[model samples]
Target chain A: MVVRGCENRSVNALVVEKQKSRENLFLIGVPCEGILDWHKIVSEVGEAVTAVKEDGQNLMVETRDGYQLLERADFLHDSCKRCIHPNPMSADILIGEPLPEGDPNLARTTVENFETQTIEDRYAWFQKEAERCIRCYACRQACPMCYCEECFVDHIEPRWTESGATPAGMQGWHIVRAFHQTGRCTSCGACERACPMDIKMTYLTEKLNHDMRDKYNFEAGLDAQSQPPFAAVTLDDKNRFTVRGE
Target chain B: MNHILEKHTLQDLLQSWRQDYDVYLPQKMENFSHFMPLTETSVLVDGDPHNTRIPPKALFLPMNEALVKFTRFGGYEDAKHEIQSRIVFGIRPCDAQAVQLLDTSFIQEDNIDPLWSERREKTITIGLGCHEPCQTGFCTTVGYGPFDRADLDAMLTDLGETYLVETFSEAGEGCFLGLPVASEEIYNQALDIQRSAHDQMPVAFETENLKGKLEQNFKSDYWDTVSQSCLGCGVCTFLCPTCFCFDIVDETQRRERVRNWDSCMFRTYSLEASGHNPRPSRVERTRQRLSHKYVYWLDQVNQIGCTGCGRCVRYCPVGLDIRAMLRQAQTLPFEVSHAA
Candidate 1:
């Protein structure tokens, strides 16, 4: 399977969870600079888009309206903008020269921006975004970690969440979904990109990821052997973080 | 009657309807536009994104609606649905046509959805014709055009500083009855704009015998080829103007039976209670989605289900264009058989 940095991390997390055996998997790693947002490109070049040529740093777009040479750096997806890792951590074969590592501060800045908002303001923003959800579950489908046979939302007899597009249902789905990816998310930003409503979802998962890093000093999918924080067994140790490597 | 509405007074004209009707227009929500109520401060963003991300179909058939509210002691009553008379402003013609297509399904002989019917009855649609039709949109390819006014009460043609308003019904006439009538030359100019806009659109695919090919090639690998990149998500269907499949779930905790939009793209949509799914994978699901729009809609209504609004094409995560898929489908081999 061809995997990017985020996908490789997801595969490693899956391997640790006994979803797939690492021996049977042969991963081809492609170094990713960033994923260009088509949304941004459209906004930039509005009409008569005949052809778009992708390059290392510029997009030569041909349109009836006008020709535009868009800077690739400006159109990078919000998730890709703050990507901490562009090189696959574990892969049998590697391709191309790996790009320089992304700044950790950039990722921290995004979460901090959300965190710095007052509780009321944060909740208000969450309400505005969550209410717009049509309950399409594109976010779930796009996430590599969301490979459940039947999602918890679909469980009929013992329904975990409301299956409608109500405020309660939408909010529950978003919050629970982000929590589920606490130590497992690799910040691919596929969910945000997939959303038809353009709801900001990476913020929710990224916050959980930030907490996982801060509290336990654990980053998901650095290795196949390490369990996520939720799945890790500590033997009732006094220090929560001490049992990770031991 | 044809009248000219000056662009500067557009907000005043829209908000003035609020006294007699609830005015809903495409308003900016985040990056894209959404159909929202016209407030005092409502500022119109003209023809930027072409159309709203979610179609005005949502205004009629809400994503979630409570059908039956259960009472204590095992009793139940129909949920109260209060529908206000609304003027949906700036609706693209393709979407208005979609509502007309959906009317055949919802307002049928046996099953007349009162809620859907009520909303349709109350809502007065005012269309804004695309002078500069969106490039992504292929309304012309689907036997509809940028100025297709099959279901609108009134249609507006943008004329730079002024708009040529063409009213088709009494309701439409009432909205702009007091405005000054557009002259013959100005009206002719609007017609020229509409004609040019319609002519600008290139035919996306060959629709001739396209339905027949899809019907015959049900077992072919075209489904696999097209659906390979699909994530089995509902974005396309949910955002679609015409796709109207719903799931009714009884929320026991809430004591209500809620109807929410369901997509054929979902695995659970066709999942039978006996742990068997008729349409199993994304391959079959994709086939169902496309075939329903192309073959089944033709079989049932003698019209294509899609409006060519291009929401699905623009917003697909994998950038899978249905136009490209159908173009590929046009190449699929199927022996032509004449009806005896």
Candidate 2:
């Protein structure tokens, strides 16, 4: 059930192991940093693993250094922490520990509360920072939680948002980003981390995260089994959208 | 509301919680800020309501996360992501509400995102009420306030010298059950102070028939007029606490498949692989943005999609006042339609 130093061990081992075990097997591991590429990993061992599995359903490889498991749905999306299907749908052997608890490096302050002297001053500071955005979508591309088949930005029939680096376009982009991740975002920090312009995109998500927690006592991605707050409704759930009482 | 922690006793409480659940608190990084795991050295409480540049959403829905990785062929695999029981400390009310709102999108009947559902299941939230409301905060205007208590297992209000912790859920009560208990007199005093603080909050927005107003003004000339000065920078959306929309794309690295976050603002955001662009004009795109929040989200969720956190207002480069836009929408002489 174990192989070492196969040269193609990372890729080949899965196929080899599946053939011998005659059972559905899932491989979870990080690509070797920097040097590791998907093609090499697949070419070296992918074919061999597939040949051995019955119905060719037994062998599968989850790439991304084990982070794909965080997305428990289909393989169409990525995972922030581990493979989406780290646990076998129906298998005997399991791999890796469950995702750890607690926020890794969440900033505690609200971006609005940051002292900037005056509203005009704060706006100016943000303007300068936002002006640096190139509309590259690096933040979007880097996020693991974005799993829409057709994003609003790309929807042509109804055209939900625009596509450009202009301020309005950028506003459309960012607003949609924050709004989409509302209850679903796990706050993995990948978007801000991936932004080439370093636009501090996390500030938006953080603000929303704060709001969700404060208003609903709900935190996204905290549990796999519980329904999202927005998707499920209770009569007692505070309706922020409801008319306020004096 | 009145709970006493021996100067460092908060650390002990955090450690105890850590044993059973992952405990998170705000920590300062060189020049930036973040919430890290609570350790002996972690500072438990501080008085800065400044919205952290990073939302706790990553704890649930991470960027560049792996939903599933597969070989080129029909070989299938499943991700074994497990939900971790945890506690988020010092969560602001706006962010708290944002998570609640997010649930509406992710946990919906037809299309529930499994990853978000998992994280939402096991986590308990402990919110820290705003002791000093931020200048950009207009939660009161959007039917929220500096210290709104819609979503929190427990809430902590700063009372000058001590923290008045109120348990709103059984889980919140359990969080404080074994820890030190607060005196009733102190709790009453903290409540009194919180009431005063709530009353003193000046930032407000008028939401009277706001959704109806937005619907009527969907095609108003006001959009072009208001957006005329807009530079189209995404600061407003990127900074707003409640704006959430994203795109997903698949990429291949060394033959391994990958999916990543994509924004609607990009020229390619709407350009399908077939080369047709839906939102070709900036004006059309702008209209979509405003209407989605004011009109669409409200219509779908029966909730206005904004919390009035003012990150959008404060961060916008061109001073695109969302409040002003909404206000104008309110007064516009347009017919409201409920038809889909």
Candidate 3:
């Protein structure tokens, strides 16, 4: 088992080669931090790294380690200081740094501030910023976590979000984005970064992250062994975050 | 410092700049205004204080950008489109920041756009401060003024007699190395002119509770009332400097693939191949437009997407004022329901 950082290309390639040898292999890559110039990175990496196109998501690598499946490090929320899934679902070899301890105090303050603010104020500011949205969906395309075969915004059957600049439609789009992230979101702030209008969508995710941690004491993508909150029902689970009757 | 560039010197500088970088400046093409290649023309930088009808993103992202062209028979064909290194001159601060905002959206993520990154990396932004703020300009209200230097590589402020050039990035400083520069006295005078212009600007909007208000009144009747007259002509999106939404379509023209701009304001904008129209009503479409910017975008990104350039407000045929709508959203009353 080989564990290293800044060896993403070689690690990914090794994982792919090993995948050919076996049905199941677990490989991990580092979580991308800050703003990245992907074009520059891809250009710099050159043709040695061939991006394997899956159904929708593509895995780019230089060599396979031993895993059939490759997992890139993902953020739990926008405020997360380290990659929650730095280690693979089950790995023979782990690449990149281990998960770092996050400042729960910062999360608490942010969540409290978010809770205190009236929904009306948030809505109004959202409308003001959304009014500038051209509906380019750049935010949707840029998010790694936003992996749906077809997004609701693109749905034609009932048309969840109309194709125009109406206030309600814009609100619906935002509500849907937040709802989808729920417990599953690793806030990486990628969506906000991708918006041409400069809409700070990360704040919304951060607010939700605070709720998940404070109320449920749950952190997403932190442990591969644990079942996701929405995915399982257990009597032993804490109910502080849930409604009483439900 | 307002030093006049003789028409001849300006042309020579443009030619020289073109040798090292792709020079982009405002050009009058037929009747409309756009940023085109100094690739061909002599006088590229025109002194227009009013925001360009089109944003500078169009120069890089383009109204019709080819993502990946492929033939049905051939598996996957690589579209080796290369963006040359360039300098965009005479751009306004609002536009420069708009580009920076775009950078966050396109460059800072797990899935980065190769095309956008290439163009952005090679491009040098030269911001020109608005000496005379436009009647519709209100960028100052939303944390950006005409002379804001947050996103510029270099800034050019117009003094009465000459232009004051201030470099903000290494690239910006490199651009002005051998060029004729104004004296320090002139530079100070340009600063004075900028201060006065900022004070003279009148449009302002309170953004303190903006996000909250929009969230509270998501289902308000105000949207219907305000958007009733909207023709959905989509001029606002097209003309907006920061509106970066586009539609991708595959077209075979003489065996070559082509794509073009698609506006969300159009009824057909969201119609899918499966015949599902999520935002069926004009009202719903209008609501989506507002909420995406105000609520969703803010929730997803960190900053307000709108730069207050007022192009949407100015060009709407129905005179649908986004600013006024935001103001109304902030003040609208709604029934509070306890999530019981």
* Candidate closest to the true structure, highest lDDT: 1
lDDT of 3 by residue, A125-190 (tens): 667666655455656655545556567976656556643334554667877887776665655555
At residue B98, candidate 3 shows an lDDT of 81
lDDT of 3 at B159: 55
Candidate 1 lDDT (Cα, 0 to 1) = 0.90
Task: List DockQ for all candidates.
Answer: 0.70, 0.02, 0.01
Could you tell me how far off, in angstroms, the CA of residue B307 lies in candidate 2 after the best superposition?
Answer: 1.7
Candidate 1 ranges with C-alpha deviation above 4 Å: A239-246, B338-340
| Candidate with the greatest TM-score versus the true structure | 1
Candidate 3 has an lDDT of 0.62
lDDT of 1 by residue, B1-340 (tens): 9999999998888878999999999889988998999888877887674789889899999989999999999999999987899999999998999999999999999999999999999989999998887867899898999999887999999999999999999989999988999999999999999999999989999898899889888999999999999999998999899999999999999999999999999999999999999999999999999999998999999999998999899888888899999999999887776311
**lDDT value for model 2:** 0.58
Q: CA shift at A37, candidate 3, in angstroms? A: 46
Task: Give a tens-digit lDDT track for model 2, residues B104-181.
Answer: 888999999888887888888888877666655677777776677767788788776656778888888888875567
Q: What's the lDDT for residue B245 in model 1?
A: 95
Ranking of all candidate structures by their DockQ, best first: 1, 2, 3
RMSD of 3: 24.9
| Order of candidate numbers by TM-score, starting with the best | 1, 2, 3
Q: Pick by DockQ: which candidate is best? A: 1
True contacts kept of each: 0.76, 0.02, 0.00
